[model samples]
Target: MRPGAIVIASSLLVCGAIIGCERDDMWEQPKTAVLGTNEFFDNDQGARMPVKGTVARGADNLQEDDLLYRGMENGKLAERFPFEITENDLNAGHDKYDAFCSPCHAKSGDGMGMIVQRGYKQPFSFHIDRLRNATPGYFYSVLIRGLRPTQLPGVKFEPDDDKVHPAVAHKLSPVERWQIIAYIRALQLSQNATIEDVPMEQRGELDKPKTEGSNGESH
Candidate 1:
């Protein structure tokens, strides 16, 4: 046989062996078809049942804490916060309030936001005695379910009226809602605080004139 012919035949055999191995791999590759029978385990399900009590990632727990998740302590609304508010938490709450609540409720929580100025319905001021004294759970309910005005147009709301109508909906997360509520409390304190409410050290700071750049003002 010619040297070239032998070389060609050897190359063909090598190519054929490579193709055969690939074919074998294709046939023998391990993967179970969906719902197909498998004898590897007893009860033979190709799709194995998840291990008992295995929770999927990011899945909400079925047994959620009422105070933490729903802001309820008993059958009624909770008066206290679900978690303790730290200074950092307050700052986060302030940021969230500015981003979401300020457009409608205003940065001062006075219900006179830019939106209200633009003819949108003015919501109740957060500093109102009714609201300032409201339970945390009441605020949580309003944040989650939201308030809708049920009274007739131009009808003024009395202090004793049921103003928190939980009909409108908002999409804030529970934590974010709680944070905004904390900021609202802070705003209420800042707005209505008496001279006695301020610490002597802080009182002096308050009396000091606010200069340019005192509150992010341009120099």
Candidate 2:
């Protein structure tokens, strides 16, 4: 036999062996031995795997322990926080209320904000019987979870994007939330006050402060 013919025969034998050993199961459908949701093959063997964690839509995992309004330590509501009402808290609450609540409830606690001026449905007055009689727990629940929507215009939309929309987590801490509540209480008292409640001399201080320009001239 010629050397080239022997080489060709050897090559054919090697090719035949390679072809015969090749697995044709790559395109085959996976066989289900156990017909259950959790059963699946990994590395050609059945295995159960845990799913990964993901952020819920519109919700943020705020560190509650670090929050100012940390709910009860032993899973009970702390009706009275350790902090007392200071001038600083009142000031901070005033500023925060203006930024957040004032858009819906005006400075006077009347539901006549700019949105209402533009034809948005006015929210209920804070002095209303239901809200006025609400406990701190009720206020906190409403502020945190928000009210349910009953009709065409909803009170507040459900948070779906933690990034864009401001959740209760983003706005106020536990302490700050309480501070705002205190400030609201103060507002309510002031509004409900009679002539007997106001001292004659100190009443003048309640008037709006005069604004002065850089040159000390009133605009």
Candidate 3:
């Protein structure tokens, strides 16, 4: 065969090979076809299998509920949790509160934290009778789920891997969160308590002791 004819044949062979190598459906226009058993089988066969024991997407069984706000497992509400509020728990809660909540709720729980100082809206004071009357469960719910901005603007916090956010807006571990509730209760009582509510002997502890300096003026 002539060299030129040989070259033309080689080019045609290469072109055919290239066309064959292209994906089967690449050049074909998409067709609207009714679902068929074989097509369904093919689609499912190619689909990624879900990890073992993976719950279905959007399943309510996997949802964290208000029960978890108290750190109790769902369906086990009657059972007492292992952790309880101790003085140490309260202290740790105070630290966490100062780090996360003090920005908005303020150190005094008066809804006048530093954010409000910069012209942000203030939160309700924990000392309010309405708030003081609320259950610890209520506080836990608010802290864990966060108030929707549409419902109560700028109050939401996102949860983390343990399903607890480091901030008040995320879900906290049951015990640590309850400790925060205990501390808030203490703050409310301190600000809004009657003398009769206090024990008579311990009432003296509420007053500050007089301090005299070298200048003889009370400090």
Candidate 4:
């Protein structure tokens, strides 16, 4: 072959190999993308523990607030809430609570949730004297740190179980954990609510009782 032709052919072969290395999806390419199996590390999976000093993406706001994320101040339970409880925060908390807590703690935090009716062990009522007096950090700690094994007696719990909230609760962001704590406090107060606790404009509504018909319908 001519020298010029040989050089051109060799260049083409090299380019083809280089392009094939990137385009050969059938060979050595991960079945999944970033979340797929990764052979580069000892773990053959993409999901691995973060390295030292690895902070969660976009977690700077939460990470910096020790009380918010850790539910502690100087290694002790915070005496008060880490942030102000606005109406918006309370509303968001209601949704989170209903989705995660009501199944076990009930809408009223009375611990008589549907799952409990279906044979799951009953948890302590949030309105209990001890919990009513408990600090806000106490509930937040439960979500982040989980219940003590001794405190979980009578319940057969597995972290993998969907019915249980502890594992799922930990997955919640720091703000979300605190929101739930606020909602629980609100739920506790609701049980012992007095007419005076109702707004003055709404107080008249409390004076009237609903009349029930023979068919168990409210008239």
TM per candidate: 0.62, 0.52, 0.51, 0.64
Taken over the whole model, the C-alpha lDDT of each candidate is: 0.74, 0.61, 0.62, 0.76
Q: Give the lowest summed-lDDT range of ten residues in model 2.
A: 157-166
Residue pairs in collision within model 4: none
Candidate 2 local lDDT, 1-219, one digit each (tens): 999999999999999998887564764445544533333444444443434675544342445552234434454443544467898888787777777887767887877888777876677777866556655554554566564443214233345412111236457766677677777767777677887788998777668575554342111
How far residue 59's Cα lies from its native spot in candidate 2, in Å, is 11
Candidate 4 local lDDT, residue 205: 74
Residue 155 accuracy (lDDT) in model 2: 31
Off by over 4 Å in 4: 1-31, 34-44, 49-64, 149-169, 207-219
Q: How many residue pairs clash in each candidate?
A: 0, 5, 3, 0
lDDT of 4 by residue, 1-219 (tens): 999999999999999998877756677665557678777778687778778987679663446677877777887777688889998888888888888888878887888999999988778788768678878876776787677655545434455534333555545877888888888888889987887799999888767776555342111
Write one digit per residue (lDDT tens) for candidate 1, span 168-197: 224566677777778788888999989999
lDDT of 4 at 108: 79
Candidate 3 C-alpha lDDT tens digits along 1-219: 999999999999999998888765765435433442233444634344576989778443365653544434453322333356688877877877777677878877998888879977666778877677766655765676554434433233233312221235433455667767778877788788799998999889879564455342111
Query: Residue 66: error of model 2 in Å?
Result: 12
Error at 66, model 1, angstroms: 1.2
